[model samples]
Every structure is written in structure tokens, then in C-alpha cells.
Target: MIRNKYVLYFFRIIVGGVFIWAGVLKIIDPLGFAQSIANYRLFPAWMAFFLALVIPWIELICGVLLILGLFPRTSALVLSLFLFAFIVLIWISILRGLDIDCGCFGSFSRRVDYTLILVDGILFGMSTILFLSSVRKKV
Candidate 1:
């Protein structure tokens, strides 16, 4: 676990800021994000539409909570879960040979590739560490 508060805060801010930025971008152009999601072909169009409507708000709220240091554990866990899901989705997309944007930053998203996996993996690790350290403090 991270024993240094500064290190923990750094991770929190970096992760939280990234999510906040991504969320805002998605919120700005939900139709574009929805289109990106549909490009994946993993889910039905209706499901993609619903997810586009809801996921950005979830990201924004959790990111704000994280940066505020309120319910840090819960926020970290939620973000970590999202990262895990994203990792899985990316892997599946790669396996299916679907060349599409990740839909991570709405219109600014990058192509779904190994590099994206690496980036998301790092974020997942950071969020997991935050979750664990926060849990440790509670005990």
C-alpha cells in the first residue's frame, strides 16, 4: 500500500483528472460517443445509446468524488471497475479484428489498439492501488 499521502494524492488527481476530461468530452457530444460505441458492434444500438447517456455522468461524478477525497475508496473502486471493463472490451475488439475508435474521449478518442490497452492497464493499476490503500486506512 502507498504509505505516503502525497503519492496517493498525486495518483488520485491524475486518475480523477483524466476521467473528468474524458467524461466532459463525452458529455459534450453524446451522439458521437454513441456512434463510437456502435462501431464496436459488441452491443446493440439501444444499449450503446443508453450507455452513452449514462456512463459519462458516472465517470464525472466518481472523478469529482475522487479529486475531492470524498469516498475515495468507492470512487477508486468504481473507476477501477470501469477500467477493467474497458480493458476487456478492448481485448475483445482486438480479437474480433474491429478497427474502431475507443470512444474514450468522445470525438477525441484514439483507435482501439495495444497502446490503448497499455494506457488503460496503467490507470487500472493506479485506481486499484488507491482502492487498496484507502481500504487499509479504514482498517
Candidate 2:
């Protein structure tokens, strides 16, 4: 149990830091973020614009809460869901042969590829574990 706690703490810090940095970068340039989302061609222009406005804030809030161990279960669950959605989007883009920046980490993103899929997959796994652990502890 102690070892599991340590591992969870490590993953929490890394994942929280990553999301916080990504949110901050996107918040710095909402227009660019919107454009990046639009590039995915997954949503309408207005929907993209709204998502650009709200998503970063959500990421920032959840990331901070996760790192601080406040509402960890909820934060981890939300972050995990977001990561899952991103993985799906990236998969679609790859399958469609749309070679484009993932727009995952703001401007510091890489092209949509299998590597990104793997990274998100790992993140999702960590988030899931965190959420489940929190729930079990509460019970």
C-alpha cells in the first residue's frame, strides 16, 4: 500500500504538471488554440471557440486540484475523461490521414501519431488508477 501510494504520488505530480502547463499555454493564446481545435475538423467553428474558452480552464482547475490532493477522485476522473476523448480524436485524425499538430499541449504539440496515442493511453491509465484508489480509500 505504501509503495502504491508513492507511485500514485509520482504519477499525480507528473500528470498535474503536464496539464497545468498545457492549460497555461493555451490560455495565453485562446485564438491560436481555437484555430488548432478547428484544424481537427471535429467540431463546428462556434463549438471550437467555446471549447477553447472553457477546456483550458477545466484542465487548469483539475490539474491543480489533483496535485494538491483536493477532490482527487473527481479531478482524476475528469482529466481521464478528457484524455480519453483526446485519444479518440487523435485516432480519428490519424485514420483520416490528417497529418497535423495534435494541439494537445498548446503550441508545443507534436503531430498526431501512435506515440501520442500511447502517451495519452498511459496518462489515462494513471488517472484511472488514481481515481479508483481515491474511491477505495474513501470507502
Candidate 3:
């Protein structure tokens, strides 16, 4: 748990910026993002498409709220949960030997691999720190 205000702000900026960028790219191509999600083979086509249409909007809103310092705790908690799910998905893909794009940054996403897992882990840590800071403030 990081209590340093500056550090938490830094995490907020990095996490928020990443989400906003990813969301914008997904917003540019819903079908493309849906295809990326489908490549994982974890979801049916309809569910993948639905997630594509909805998840990016959540990411964008949470990112904006995180950076704007409005409902930071809720934003950070949500992002943390989101990242956790991503980590799980990536792990499953790896275990199943599925070679697919992460669908993280839309078209810019890399293959689902250990490196990507590490990156998501770092982002998760950042969100955790941000969430902890927010909790500390409230208590």
C-alpha cells in the first residue's frame, strides 16, 4: 500500500492514460476489437461482441474518472478487478496454447504471452496501490 500522494497520482496517470488510449483505439473499430476477443475462444461470438461494445466504454469512463480524481477509489477498484480478470484470461490462453492477440490496446495489442502477463501484473499493482491509498484516505 503506497501512501505517498505523488506516487498514487503517478499510478493514476499511467493507469488512466493506458485505459483511455486502449478505449479510444477500440472505439475506432468495434468489430476489430470483437474479433480480437473472439480469438481467445473463451466466449461465444455474441458475448465477445457484446463485451467489445461495452467494456471499452467502462475503461474509458473509469480512466477519466481516475485521472479527474472523481471517485478514485471506485475507479481504481474497478480497474484492479478488470486487470485481475485479464491476467486470468491470459493465463488460461497460455495454458491452452492459444496464440492470439491480447486485445488490450485494440490494434496495438501484442500476442498473449508471459511478457504481456507481466505488463498486466504491473498495471494491477499500480491499481492496487491507488486503491489502497484511496482506502487509507477514507479511513
- The alpha-carbon lDDT assigned to residue 62 of candidate 3 equals 97
Q: How displaced is residue 95 in candidate 2, in Å?
A: 0.6
Give per-residue CA lDDT, model 3, range 32-69, as digits (tens): 99999899998999999999999999999999999999
**In terms of TM-score, which candidate is stronger, 1 or 2?**
1
TM-score for each candidate, following the candidate numbering:
0.98, 0.96, 0.97
Q: Model 2 — TM-score against the truth? A: 0.96
Candidates sorted on lDDT, descending = 1, 3, 2
User: Scored by Cα lDDT, where does model 2 land?
Assistant: 0.91
**lDDT (Cα, 0-100) at 136 in candidate 1:** 93
lDDT (10s digit) by residue, model 1, range 1-139: 6789999999999999999999999999999989988998978999999999999999999999999999999999999999999999999999999988999997788999999999999999999999999999988
Compare candidates 2 and 3 on TM-score and give the better one: 3
Q: How displaced is residue 62 in candidate 2, in Å?
A: 0.4
Off by over 4 Å in 2: 1-3
Model 2, residue pairs in steric clash: none
Candidate 1 vs 3: which has more lDDT: 1
